[model samples]
Target: MGEIIYLRDQHFAEFHDKCFLLLSASNHIELSRQLTKTLHHMLVTKNTPVALYHYLPTGQLRLIYYFSFGSNIEYEDEISSIRSFEALSHSQLTYYALNGEHETWGYVAHPPSSYIGSTHWISSLVDIAMHQLGLLSAKCIDRQQAKLKTSRRLLSKDIHLFTNIEEILDRHRQRWRDIFHACGICLASQGALHRFGHCPSDHQLLQQLSWLSNDAEQTDVIEFEGSHQGSLAVKLSLAGTHHGWLLLFRDQPFTNKHVDSAIHRALSCWLTYEARMARVLADDLALTIAALEISHTNRQFITTAQQLASLKPAIHSAPRAVTSAEQNNK
Candidate 1:
């Protein structure tokens, strides 16, 4: 027998298809299930426990399927007097049945025997398995890319309606509230940047023509300390920095695919909205400064023109008085 390793249910889902493929080929479902249960039992072992997994062609750990007998168990409280295959580490094993290694049928637990040989069977199994998994992974990645593309387009359209940051925040407040209700946590988050000339995050930014800081983003988190609660934290990045983040948690976290997708889409929309708002605000500020400069220039022109008008009369009177003095002397 071999050792089974402990892993969470979500972790199991990650490699579920691959493991099932191996088991179905060998008709080893019953054996695999028993092995998983046994692994759960050995999670709290005080002594060294065997780690069982198949080495993939990609040089990555795969099917790290199970662990061994232990003094206690956390997964199952009431242990039945069930005897499954015992797990043993390589050092403890007397022999390894290399013939047991195959694509459909993984290497099974065997009494230790000493033999060092690399056969075509092990190599072929790894190659075929790697190809199949690689294709599956590629397909998944493509689907995700499509979803993100669609999400970005929709969000960009929605953001155009918001004129300013205050409007964006107000409109999204309800959605944020709903997110909190669903996720079981609340995060009061904001983004801040000083005006171009006033920005002081870095000395270099001050010298630059654009007043934007090289890097100045803040992210804060406060976890929920409630019973049976779980939280999901996701940060949305734009232009190489975190522009926004979403905080969600719940007493009983909903694991539905639809809910997760909706949350993700909404967060993306919020980030796009924020970015657009910032641009609009910057444009408005520029307009305001130009207006102020024009007003100041007009005031100075009015004062200078009035002074010139007053000096004209004084010059005209001085010429007449000089003429009258010369006539009296003659």
Candidate 2:
């Protein structure tokens, strides 16, 4: 069993307790569905723009979800990669293949080495995940008559069946929350976070988060000061469309010790959840539209058939009337 670590961030600690309470009674997919619904409400209430990205085994990163308030950002570009889900990095090209640890949910890279969070915690998650995988793999091998290679291939092909979109979204959100808890301390001093544009150049920091971009990325930042008179500002760029950053500020000059780490943790989770929900909603919309078209077509066909059947008696009566008129003339 994995040991649960305490998050020292006050706000995050409260949120985590709430999350544990929410998750205790439910399974994984149910928890995620609830989380997405809750996150959507939060997005509307908070009026924040958030996006989620999932790392693919492929070198590219895909945008799984996003939620924006009054921001001008569009989710898709019907043509090319303009707004169409963009790929940020290749898996093999990165250090994840070498020193990085993999987990049932996903890989976690800690700071000093990586900025996401604790590498040890990430490694532990990976180990447990791998153990589960091993058990699953054994079951497959026992049930099948094929050799190990064939069994492996069969299991790989069916992995998606066992792990669907909802599970991925849930796990992704949770891992992101942990990362935020660990990394949130950095951005607590920042002010309200909002959507912004990104820089075109490849940034080293962005590269680690799999956000490296040649073209300018969208920027999201937290302005250090409120709508008051005068205040100094510091910016923290977050991972989002076109190099988005989060800005933090203070009314009076304050040190980093005053930062609220809990909010940062919450934001991380919110961003990931929002992104997943966005993609799922987009896909759902497409499916619903298609289903509606099919239903309309079927309805029209049924109406036409009914009308044709109703006209049959009238045609038969007309012929008989003509025959009777001919007999009378004779």
Candidate 3:
């Protein structure tokens, strides 16, 4: 702490601000190696391992940079789940929020245990300075992406993705299955689980358990937070004559509105299938009743024909026609 403390530090601030302003105010979305390495060295003096983890609102971690050639992908993976949900490291090696209020961008880079409470203020100061500037960079990137997506959509000839209703439903069903390991959709009407898709080899066990896990009593959406806020689940009904829950599970909370919109759309798709099935079944039942009625009428006609034939035989035995020629002969 005492080393960096000085009356005038024009040299350090000038060097640090050069990289900071370049990264935060640049038109390019991609981070160059040179700028990042310079910036890392400026603030992160840790000869110890450090990694910059960019967290998505979906609760996924993307590695931005790793320093000191100490930690590799394995180390990053080990702590990814913890970073996704936990606000603090296990060691409590101070992490800067970098605008935790908006969840715009926050990273964790724990130094050596020696720096736990010592001289870490400089690192925290760097993060605080990066906050306002990072927001600007994030907004610019978002706008650029929005325009690209809009352009792609406009250039496409068709908006509808699938040719048939079943295709669309199947796509959604597959998405449901991917929400978690061996994820699936189950029917509430069936006492036994009726899994729709994403069946792993061991999914049979999951199928048996899905029926029991449905505690969704209300029609509105319900959120369940998992241990240490590391996992999140949102439950809503795919309701109709036979209602079932549409659920999503993620490593982090489902705070993204876009994700919520997609979930609701899936629920709507399921509801549409339910309504269509009801209509189809009613149509089939009507056709079945008509067929049975026709068969019954045909049976009655055959019985009447047989009765008429029997009467013809009785007439032949009981009566004879008188002729005028026979009367003249008498």
Candidate 4:
């Protein structure tokens, strides 16, 4: 019987003119009805396409909820033609997991353009919004889990840890190689670093990331050409103050379609899990220190714990509306 919580007033402002609401409630038909009822007023006022993303509780979090409204010309034409499909015009509701089990509820819609050459900006905005909401929901769950000692789970299951920094870098390198192979893309060459200092290859591209500033948590996609033409460089800043970058290269460029969205979604999920894992690791370290009768005031132990604490995942304090200016730039 967990309580349902809605996003704050600031988040509502971020929704802009479009109707958007994010809430956390238990997974049940009754709760879904409650959500539908809540959005009823919006639906009547503007029959824009509605999307709901339901996130179930994991070992890390408690409640999950997502709702959005926008107009998609392509989806309107497609769904409206379906006979007897009675929901608000071009509306859909989806239920999915933050970590596992991929499922979309209600009528699904695509980006409002052909998937081939178009930028699909409208759909991309919706997708990114949903992704951000999902991440935020997971952060909420992690916060709740932190309050219960018995609920803490192992972070190693989600994040791979090494004894040293070098090992971590090597592991990331190997992971990129694996991802390229699995995605049917060849990896020409790749490198990862903390601050994009100096790199032999892709120096200019890596340097571009510097402009994003240390506080930018969003993913940046860069297209490059060299031995492997049409390659894409996906770079993301890990959660927390442990300044590190994950750079991956693929032989093919990602479209603004399903493929690109899927990759980013997967990466986002991994980072969320990694953030939770960091918390678990920090807890374990503290417990170990105590078990060994080490003084809590020990500088080394305190420093290590503080470092881990700083690595906690970045959760969006408020929702962000994708503006037309930003879309044009992209």
- TM-score each candidate: 0.29, 0.23, 0.35, 0.24
Clashing residue pair totals per candidate (backbone < 3 A): 15, 40, 0, 3
Off by over 4 Å in 2: 1-100, 103-285, 319-330
For model 4 the local lDDT of residue 243 reads 32
Mind giving the per-residue lDDT tens digits that candidate 3 earns over 138-186?
6654554454344334323222343322333343444333322323443
Error of 2 at 70 (Å): 30
Give model 3's TM-score versus the native structure: 0.35
Q: Residues 198-243, candidate 1, lDDT per residue (tens digit)?
A: 1123332222212122324422321212221233334334335434
Better of 3 and 4 by lDDT: 3
Best by lDDT: 3
Candidates in order have lDDT scores of: 0.33, 0.30, 0.38, 0.34
**Predicted candidate 4 versus true structure: per-residue lDDT over 190-225, tens digit per residue:** 234432222235565444445434436443333332
Off by over 4 Å in 3: 1-14, 17-46, 55-64, 70-81, 84-87, 113-129, 132-330
Error of 3 at 57 (Å): 4.3
Worst ten in a row by lDDT for model 2: 91-100
Candidate 2 C-alpha lDDT tens digits along 1-330:
345455454323344444443344232223333333333332223333223333333322322233333322222221112111232132211112112134222222111112233444333333443344344334433433233234334334443343332332332333322322212211111121221122122242233223312325422221121222111112222222121222211122211232232212212122222233223322332333233445567779999999999999988878444687788999
2 or 3, greater by lDDT: 3
